[model samples]
Target: MAKKVVTIKNLEYEYPDGTSALKGINLDIFEGESVALIGLNGAGKSTLLLHLNGILQSDEGDVEVLGMKVAENIREIRGKVGVVFQDPDDQLFMPTVFDDVAFGPINMGFSEEKVKEKVRMALERVNMSGHEKRAPHHMSLGEKKRVSIATVLSMEPEILILDEPTSNVDPRARRNLIELLNGLDITKIMATHDLELVSETCDRAIVMFEGKIAANGDVEEVLTDSKLLESHGLEAPVLVRLFRDVMNREYIPIRLEDVIEKPNKYKI
Candidate 1:
């Protein structure tokens, strides 16, 4: 098996006022794999993400990124785990797109030329090749979201952690973001409610409920389990539910792309 890139064990955390945010989360993410962390509001999804890159320290247990402990190796872990917060406004605080994208590399002490190069390459990856001078405040929300991702991409992170990549984006912009993420070819851990995006982008799924990992397994296997989904305030994909009945099979298709593999064997 590949070396675990992100590892957590018995992780428990609480806010300053003693509001328990996470109970105990144990997970392992392999290199270059795409995984989704799905749960309802107040489910500790975002709190768990903060632990990944050492943004918030755990009261008990530990977090390791790239084989280094998050507490002692926060510098290295931050570089390896690029966290794009749920709100782009939280991430893209710089005056201009180029400034925002260049923040990470600049903080890492890259030279001017190198930072500029990284910014350009990251923007190009998001298909926003010429928005360097644009202020983040002036850009639309969708554009700011892409630029926020570019900020992390500029740092060349080993794992991309996105809180909610599709929230509030228009359908067109959401599709564009999906395609952008798909083309990145980097290890990703996304926390989102968009099951459609999860089905299309993630190879595996992990569900969190009240700070506990309620379910974890192959994306198709878990996402199609209507009983499990319903119990956790989620729903099975409509097409997956329909195919489950028509095929008279235990397993259901999770993504439209899967239909191509067995076009005649299954129908919606």
Candidate 2:
């Protein structure tokens, strides 16, 4: 049987001024599943990601990540849930890339030697090797993004949570980021506005609208539902819409590899 990684029930949040952010969100994320959280701005996607890592305490409801409740075990939960914030500038605060990537592991009290090793591995994993000596401000947007992921990866968390992983990246960099995410075998939940990235990197998707979950299902189902996507200020990818024109709805493929590997060839 599959292990239940995170369970959220009646999850709710509000700002100090009583502005509601998340409203009674209920979700279950299984181990090793790659899921996408899609929503328009002010839809509470970032707010929800903060809650998963215990960075933001909610006004109501319970959140359990990796079998541990977030509120009571915040310290432990933060160590297990690695959150990569939307803005690389906000996330990578250390002057040097090495310091930023080593912060998390060091915070967990890893020995200097072990932390060094971990940071090296993390940067290599994100293909940001040899950037350790560079200043965060000196790197390009794409380079900064990878370094930010390295920061979280060095901690070796069980669940990986990211907000707007591709927000300001160029087309080539965006594709590279998607490929890097696809290669990771960890349990990942990404909060993104890029439907194409979601379609390519995630198997399941959850849509948030105005502090509530709008829809949740297989990537293809949620992404291809023209009315649903339109309602949430989104549209299906070009590949998705093109495939839908010819393929049976029951077998709408989401991954690029699926379309390329299949024997039945239809030019889109």
Candidate 3:
């Protein structure tokens, strides 16, 4: 059986102003799973993510990372779960890419030589090799996003958490980012409105609505449910809509490759 890297049970949280963000949430994320948290604005997706690494303490329940309680093992948990924020600029504050990537390892007490090696491997994983000296502020948005990922990668976390990872990138950048995400083997959890990205890279889909889990199932099953998606302010992927609505076919294709594999099967 796969290991459960993250486990949340009856989780609840409220903002300082008494705005409830998460309510009675329960979830288990297993090792090597790529899960997508999909929800409309104010639906508690980000709030739930904050609890994963101890960024926010739960008000009413338990959150465990790799068998340790988040509330009591914050420092240790932080080292194993890396979070990449929605905005790359929020993560890349150092003057150069090298500094940003090396910050985590340096703080973790790695030697200078080890930090350099970590930074190099992390950057290479993100395809950002040989640009260490470049200032983050001067790089393109896509490059900055890669650097932001490298910052967390340098830590060698067991799980990777991302928020709106493809939020502001162009088509080429988005494609590259998708490829990079698919290549990673660690457990991943991402909160994103990009259904297309979910269709391509995620194994499971979780729909969050009003601080509760509305749906949790395989990516294809969840994405094919147009009514379920529509009720929660989400739309099915373009291919799903095309095959189910326009083409009037009962079979839904969530990814482009599905259609490409059997064009005649989906023909009108």
On lDDT, the leading prediction is 3
Candidates 2 and 3 compared: the better one by lDDT is 3
lDDT of each: 0.88, 0.88, 0.94
lDDT (C-alpha) at residue 180 in model 3: 97
State the lDDT at 245 in candidate 3.
83
Q: How accurate is candidate 2 locally (lDDT)?
A: 0.88
Worst 10-residue lDDT window for candidate 2 reads: 246-255
Over 4 Å off in model 2, which ranges?
A: 245-252, 263-268
lDDT tens digits, residues 122-218, model 3? 9999999999999999999999899999999999999999999999899999999999999999999999999999999999999999999999999
Candidate 3, residue 20: Cα displacement in angstroms equals 0.5
Give me the displacement of residue 156 in model 1, in angstroms: 0.4
State which candidate, 1 or 3, has the greater TM-score. Answer: 3
The candidate with the higher TM-score, 2 or 3, is: 3
Backbone collision tally, model 2:
0
lDDT of 1 by residue, 69-157 (tens): 99999888888889988889988878888888998899899999999999999999988898999988988888988998999999999
